[model samples]
Target: MVDPDRVLVPTLGRPREDEALAYALETFPDADVTLLAVVTPLDAPLSEGGVLERSEERTARARASATDLLESVADPTATERIRVETADGRPGTVIPQYASTEGVDHVVMYGHGTDTSGFVRRILGRGIAATVVERTDEPVTVLE
Candidate 1:
C-alpha cells in the first residue's frame, strides 16, 4: 500500500492492543499519526455541575492515555509527526466521522477486543475497528 498522508488510530482510556500505535509510527514516518480518544457521554442522570465535572475528567483521562501510549513506545524521532487528541462522542461514530472529515488517508485500529472490559466488548459488538471499516471509505488496517 502507498504511504498515507494522515493516519488515525482510535484509542480509549484503556488500549486493547499497544502495538497499533507503534506500528503506525514506524510504518509511516512521513505521515501524521493522530492518536484519537473518544469520550462517550455518560447516560447517568446527574446535576449539570456533576455532568460537566465528569465530562472534564473523562477528557483528561483520555488525553493522558494517548500520551502514555506514545511515551511507552519511546520513539522520540517521530514526535514531530504525532498528535494526540480527544473527541466527544461514541467511538463507533466519532472514529469514522473523524477519518472521513479530517482528510485521513488511512486508519489503523486494533481488531476484536477493546478497552479492558469484556462487558464493553459485548456492548460494542464486533468492535470499534470493525465499525470504522463498515462506516468509512478510507483504507483501514486492523492489527491483531
Candidate 2:
C-alpha cells in the first residue's frame, strides 16, 4: 500500500482485461504501467483471434493483443507512460517472477474466470491472481 508508482497489469486476452487495465490507470494515474501477457501451453481449442495457431504464432498474437488492449483501455487523462510485454510460461509462475525481477510495486489483475474451470481449480488450487497474491511480495489488486 505504499501508493504504487510502478504498476504491473497482467492480461489474458479476456473481456475482463478492460476492467483491470482501466482500474490500474485510473487508480494510479501517475504510475508507470506495464501490460504483460504470458503465453502458456495451448489446449485443444486454444485460439487467438478466432483461429488456431502454433506456439510461436500464439506468442506473437498475445503480444499484439496486449498492446492493443492497453492502448484501448488506457486512461487518456493520465500522463504516465505505458509498456507492453510478453513471455512464454504459466501465468501463475511467470507473473510473480516478473514482478519481483522488474521491481513492480503493484499488480492489477483479474481473478479466476471462464478460461479456467471449477474442477480444475478444485484440483489445482488457486488461479493466477490468487497464486500471484500468495507468491509475490508486491501488493496485488484483483479486479474481478
Candidate 3:
C-alpha cells in the first residue's frame, strides 16, 4: 500500500487507541498524524450554568489527556508532524467529518472485539471507530 500523506487516528482514551496509534506511527513514519478526540456532551441533567461549567471542564480534561497521550508516544524528531485536536460532537460523525475536511489520506483505528460485550457495543454504535469507517471514503486500517 502507498504510504499516506496524512493519517487520522481517533482516540477515546482507550488502550486500543494507543495500539492503533503506535501501529500507524510505525507503519507510516512519514505521514502527518492527527490525533483526534471527540468529547460527547454530558448526559447528566443539570442547571444550565452547571452544565456549561461541566462541559468546559470535560473539554479541558480531554484536551489535556490527549496532549499527554500524544506526547508520550510521539517521537521527538517527528513532533512537527504530530497534531493534537479535539471536537465537540459524536465521534461517529465528527471523526469522519474531520478526516474529510482535512483531506486525510487514510485512517488507522482499532476494531471492536468479537466477544459478547464488544458485539453489543458495536450494535449500539458505541464503537465509534467502526462508525467512522462506514462514514468515510478514506481507506481505513483496523487493528485488532
Candidate 4:
C-alpha cells in the first residue's frame, strides 16, 4: 500500500487531538505525521500580567502539551516521523499553506461537529478542515 507523504493535524488546545492522531498513525503506520499547533495571537499587544499575556503563555503551553501528548502515543524510535509546527496565523490559512508546500497527501483534522454559524464560522468559513480541502489538491480526513 502507498503511504501518505504526510498527515497534518491542526490543533486548538484540544486534548482529544492526541487520540485522533494516534488513530491516524495506526491506520497509516508508514506515513509521516505532523501535529500542528497554531498560535493565533490577539489583535492587541499583551499588557504585563494581563489576559493577553496569559493567553500567549497558554499558547506556548498548548504546544508543549501537544508534543508531550504525541510522544506518549508513539514509540521513541518512530517519534522522528512526528513533527510539531507552530505558526502565528489563522488555522484555516496556515494548514492549507503548509499542506501545499510540504507535499502532504492527506490532512487529518479533528472534527468539532457540524455546527456552523456565528462569528467563528463566518470568520473561518467552514473552518480549517473545509478550507484545507478546498484549497489543497490533497485529500482531507476529519477525525471526530
Candidate 5:
C-alpha cells in the first residue's frame, strides 16, 4: 500500500475540488489523505475592530466554510483514512507546516489551467501551487 501521509487540496468554492479529491483517492488507495482548507486572512490593515478581531472573525467563517465544503465532498462510506483540517494562515506557510508536523509523505493538489486568454496569467498564477512545491520536501502531484 502506498502510504501517503498527507494530501492537500486547495479549494475555492470550485467544483474541480471534487474531481481532485476523487482522483487522490484512486491514486493512493491506502494513503492517509487529509483535506486541508487554508483560510487566508483579509489583507486590509487593522481598523476600529483591531487586526486580531478581524482575523478571528475571518478565521471563524473560513473554518465553517471549509467544514461545509469538505462535508459536501466527502464519502461517509469510504475508508477511514481520510481526515479534514482547517488552518488560518498563508497557504504556503500553513500547508508545509501541517505537512511537516504531520509527517506527510506526499502532497496532492489540482492546478487551475490557463484561461482562454494567453498563457501569461496561467504561468504567473501558479504561485500557490509552485510555492507549495518549493516549500515542501515531499512529492507533489498537481492535477490539471
Candidate 6:
C-alpha cells in the first residue's frame, strides 16, 4: 500500500477533531502526523496582560494543549510518529498555508455539521476544510 509521508490534521479542540486525527492515524499507519491548532487573536484582550505578552502566553498554552491532545489520541506505540504544532491566524488560512510550506502530503479536518449558523461561519464560509480544499493542491480528507 502507498502510505502518505506527511499528514496534517487541523484541530479546534472538538470531539470530531480528535476523531479525524484518530482516523488519519489508523488509515495511514506509517505517515508522520502533525496535530495543528491555530490561535486567532481576539480584538478584545483575552487577558489583562500586555497584548504581545498575552498572545505569546496563549500560543504557548495552545501548543501544550495540542501536544496533550495528540498524546491522548495517538496509540502509545505510535507516539513517536505524531507531532504537535500551533500557528497564529485563522484556521482556514493557516491550515493550507502550513500544508504548502511544510510539504504536507495530505490534510484531515473535521466539519461542525450543517445545522449551525453564526458570525464565525459567515466569516469563514464552509469552514477550515473547505478553505483548505480551495487553497491547497494537496489531498484533503474531511471527517464529520
Please give the lDDT score at residue 140 for candidate 3: 88
Q: Clashing residue pairs, candidate 6?
A: none
Candidate 6 lDDT score relative to the true structure:
0.77
lDDT of 2 at 76: 58
Candidate structures ordered by lDDT, highest first: 2, 1, 6, 3, 4, 5
The clash count for each model shown is 0, 0, 0, 0, 0, 0
Per-model lDDT: 0.77, 0.79, 0.76, 0.70, 0.65, 0.77
Candidate 4 ranges beyond 4 A from true positions: 44-51, 54-59, 113-125
In model 5, residue pairs whose N, Cα or C atoms come closer than 3 Å (at least 3 residues apart or on different chains), thus clashing, are: none
Candidate 2 residue-wise lDDT, 1-144, digit = tens:
467879999877767887888898888887899998878766422223424677778888889899788768765555348888897777778899999999999999877553677887776666667778999898998876
* Tens-digit per-residue lDDT, 1-144, candidate 3: 788999988876656577787888999999999988767755521111235567778777778877887778777887798888888776677888998999999998877432338566655645555677789999988887
| Model 6 bad stretches (over 4 Å) | 44-53, 113-115, 118-120
Model 2, position 140, has a per-residue lDDT of 92
List ranges where model 3 is wrong by over 4 Å. Answer: 44-53, 112-119
Q: How far in Å is the alpha carbon of 10 misplaced in model 3? A: 0.7
Error of 6 at 143 (Å): 0.6
User: Over the stretch 3-36, how does candidate 4's per-residue lDDT look in tens digits?
Assistant: 6878877776654677678777888788888888
For candidate 4, the lDDT comes to: 0.70
Candidate 2 local distance difference test against the native: 0.79
Q: What TM-score against the true fold does each predicted structure earn? A: 0.82, 0.83, 0.82, 0.75, 0.72, 0.83
Model 5 C-alpha lDDT versus the unseen true structure:
0.65
Best by lDDT: 2
